[model samples]
Target: MTSQYKSPRPLLGAALYASILDSLKAWLKSDGLAWLFAFKAALAAILAVGISMRLELPQPKTAMVTVFIVMRPQTGLVLARGFYRLCGTMVGVTVAMTLIAQFGQYSDVFIALTAIWIAICTAGAARNRNSRSYGFVLAGYTAALVGVPALQDPNAAFMIASTRVAELTLGIVCAGVVSALVFPLHASDEIETTLRAQSSSFFSYIAKTLPSRKAVEDVVAMHEHLITSLVNFESLRVVAVLETHGMRSRSQRMKRLTSELMAASTRFHILLHFRNQLRLSGDHQTLDTVNRCVGAIGRLLARSPDVLDTYASATGTAQRLDRLRLRVQRHLAYVAKQDGFTPVSSLNLATASDLINRFGTELSAYVHTYASLQDERHSRENWLEALTPKTDPFVALAAGARAAAATLTLGFFWIATAWPSGSTALAQGAAICALASTATNPFRLAIQIAGGTLIGGVVGTILVFGVYPHLDGFPLLALAIAVATMPGAFIMTRPKVAGFGIGYCVFMPALAGPDNPQSYLPEAFMNDAVALVIAMVVAAAAQALVMPATSLWFRHRITARLKAEIATAYGAPLRGLRAEFENGVRDLMAQQLMLPRHEGLPIRIPMAWLNSVLEIGTAIIDFREAAADITSRAGLSHLGPAQAAIRAVLPLFKKNTGELRSVAIDALRDSMLAARLAADDATLLPSERSRYRDLLTALNRIKHALRDPQNALGQTGQPSVAAPSSR
Candidate 1:
């Protein structure tokens, strides 16, 4: 009998194994902690800057920007968040200047506009679309920057504005400098992964395609899926800027490779459509040419440009096809089934051999035509468009106005209270607004800005009074300030965006009054506290009325999304499936948070219908795959009259494709009708023979799964009625 416990191994061997294992665990823990602290510290630093701006530094009116240059550390998301913060701040500054200047003397008017700004930001977040976010952020911060400052003595406003602009420029530069010095991110490996995944998807789809009638539809659907997943490459492109600091020479080939990959995707889509449209007597020559093109693209992905020359030349139509066929056959013979990829020969080899022998003469012309087509549309659907961006619960959780209000309030408090000599309420507002501009949550962002401003003010005072006078002159003091700035800058390179706070606090105080002997912390604290209270109050008021953004907005947008999904699901199954695949890509890019995990987080945005609709779309993909599988096995197109059946199939497949899509809608509609009838005994038909048999059955099954899909789908691995598979 086998014992449950084993005797101890040799002491040395056991010790070595345990030590290595322990070290790995320790390293992982250490790395994870570093990442976590770095993120929090960055955020904390940004908040500290807001505090500095509110303190009684000499020129406390300078606009301060804290940059957090995050390289996703994951190559795919390696974009610097620099632009987002920069744009948000600039827009806020402009809005603050305009609104304050226009409504300076009219007290209530400024409050009214502040409310409007909150409403606009909230509404901007209503949809899960990426493009819309840019607008929301722009508007939210603009209000904060402009509204809070106008509360100060009107004459001091312009000077505050000038100082604010100067501070902002300084903040932005500081952030960049810090980012460059810290751990920089890049996009090299991410682009490669995207291409590899697409290649991998093709082979996986092919495995699901064989012995299937809707083969072309499967191809089209899979093509769209990969395209969507890959487009997020746009985010990576931003990392290209990191090259200016000089070290991306190795990836110089990336630009061309990416372009080629995009071109190939478009070409593959065309070939798939052609295969679906071909007749029973479709020329084998075209098939061969298409095969060659697919192989060419795969080769490009699998090997570096340098490695490809080792392969034998592929000149002429038939020769090219042979090279492609040879490569594919090798894959089919060698690749493990779990690998989920192989060349196309195993898919249509019978059609291939016969076509080569019978239509050898036509091969060159078809190849020529295919090449021309590829050339014509190669650049249209690029990796950038495939994955550029979208919206989600992340946006819903965003609080734009709260942040703007916080910053503005802090600035306003300092000006109204008269702590910092040269600073106006408007300048403070501008600083707060700019800092809060990039925050997803207005409240949290406001806090961060307030905290940062305080920290910066403390540092500035310490340097200006505690250190400045002792220094020989302005130049020496400036030198001292610059030395203090390096560490702050280094910290800013990480994402928390807080390092800007340290720099602001250290330098802005010196800018305000050169080497002043007096310390200003006590008065600065009073002004900061007052400003915090006012900003919070203003933000709350704005959120409550005059175009409030509520979950109601989320419901409206999600409802519309649900209807669109339903409509797409009801189109011709094949083509409708294509559209659905496109929507999947949008979801993948915009809402980085994966679904089915929604319940893990507290419900932030109130779009319950969207969650429901997304489930429905997921169901439709499964249904389409299941239906196609059954239809293919039945050989619906080639029943008894084989040739005639094949001829008849084109129209039916082409025509019924449209009608079949209505099947989903009909099932939904008929189920409602059946439910009504079932309630009345007089209208009930024999349970098994009811006119609504199919529709009712489909509806009941959907109902069962909807009520408890985890159990039905068997995620827990107990007994279950499986939801239809997406093949």
Candidate 2:
């Protein structure tokens, strides 16, 4: 009894140790990566400063600031950012030299010309996406860095430009090297891991959504998440291509896989739309049939956690999907012969069958492309089409005008006041405007930037006045700088505070102005710091007040663009039509989601518009395909009413008028009648029969989608027409 009782304390002690160890492991897995990234960033900043000081550059802080600006957790991002920064710097330097040479004698003219250049670069930044946007940002800011200082001393413009370029190059090189060599995190590995996770989650999503009665809002949220993941994946892929030869070789396959995923997702969405329509119509028999078929496919898509872990397993999944596709076609024929199906229900069943078959085909292709990543001898496939993002020209132009206005306003202030730190203010404001132009909510980002700069200024002042005076050597200087910056670097890893971190790390060294023989002029430091803060405040105001993207009018404009995607489906070339249409509409939706929500605008309006666009656009594409097949095999003469029906709806896509909607619905009813008559003709060849039947299905889907009371088109008064009976 004594021995048994004595062992309980030891057991409890061991259990407690185990629990603590587990907690530590969990923290390491989550926050540990961020800590590692922070350490690497600090190391890069130190190396850049050390190199710049050793080279006896005029200001080592510029180099240090550049390191923080470009250093990322992954090697590929660092390299890609550094490469673009160098390019932008070169372009900016060239432009600055030209502007200074031409207008340096006239300060007003020089300032105006610099503002124009900044405007152009800002527009480019807003127009583009991903790292390419960073290039435009740098181009806009570098001009200010070079031209503002050179305006006071034109003779030294070349020297100023050269030094800036050299410092930036040194910083870029250091960041790239450190990121690649020191505890490297390759983008390829991240991509692979992301692919596995996304694939698994997507499979689960399909399994859950297919046969269930999930709300439309839930589906929309998931769709938004998937679209975001797709965009992020593309960004990672671009950087991965720059990081390793293996990734470069596999780039086409990766692109192909993305395209396949997009296509497959679209098909699944259409399938869901049909099932939803069936359920809404209260056609329990047809809905049950569709559910059973969909549930079977979902079960097959249901994958084990490690299903995508190996190429062989993925290949097996692909084979199963291929077999399922054939089975679906046979099942479609069986469903069509069932006696209880009404005309509308039959049409719904056929469309659902077609969608499931197409989805399976696309899913199989996606799996095959994924598996091809591990195969060295995989043949080159046709290049997958790139997503054509629909950026509003007005939005881009407004961003440009805002940046230019901010720069010109600041420039005038500098000239009017003739403050010693005016040049610094102008440069800092221009950089702030240009860098924040592409942000979803530039005003919020500007506020974060201002806060970060304030903190950075305080830290820099203390370090320069209090800490640096006691420091003796470059190593200690490096140590002090690293210690000061590491927290900001760590903050950078958390997206919520990333803007603050960026502002802190970048502006801290800049405010300190650490040089070879560092000058600690408390007065000048205070002046520069105050100027920088005021400039950021002005930039923030401009972002919020000057054609703010968050405005109701801007949201309306984006909504208009989202609706216009149906026009793409109607008129765009058939080649890559589906991908282009889907990406364009989804991209606009993504942009809309990025804008801060307003009380006046219900999110449901845009969500409804998105659903309507996808439903109608997809039907139009299928209608076109079926028409093309029927036209080639038979003739377009019989399909005239269907074609007319599609044309009638195009105008309604822009502005859903009751009159236009009624006309479209009438045309659709007539077209359905004509298509049924054509299909019933015994003279029709067996080969041509299926195409005509497909045309009817597409028309039926379009008509039903338009009639749905939940979408943008439905808000219009109902059509004053009657449907033909199945009997």
Worst 10 residues of 2 by lDDT: 718-727
Candidate 2 ranges beyond 4 A from true positions: 1-17, 213-217, 303-306, 388-390, 631-634, 716-727
Residue 6 shift from truth in candidate 2, angstroms: 8.7
Top-TM-score candidate index = 2
Give Cα distance to truth, residue 37, candidate 2, Å: 1.8
Clashing pairs in 2: none
RMSD of 2: 4.3
For candidate 1, lDDT tens digit of each residue in 1-727?
3476655676778899999999988975565544543443343334324333444333322322232222223322222344444565566666666777788777556655654564356445433233235445544544554345545556776665555544444444444443444553344434445534544554344333322334343433453355455445444544553543331432322333333343334333333433432322243543444455344534443443222121121124325544555555454334323243232222233222222222222322223322322232343222232322344433343434433344345444444565543233333443343333333333344454445545656665566557755877435644564454434544444446553443344234323333123344656644544443344344444333322234334333332343344345434467435333444433432332222123323222212222333333333443344334323322332212211211221221122233433443344444434332432334233431232222232233333223332211112322111111121
List candidate 1 stretches off by more than 4 Å. Answer: 1-94, 118-151, 155-163, 166-233, 238-388, 392-461, 482-526, 529-566, 569-727
Count of residue pairs whose backbone atoms collide, per candidate: 42, 0
TM-scores, all candidates, are 0.47, 0.94
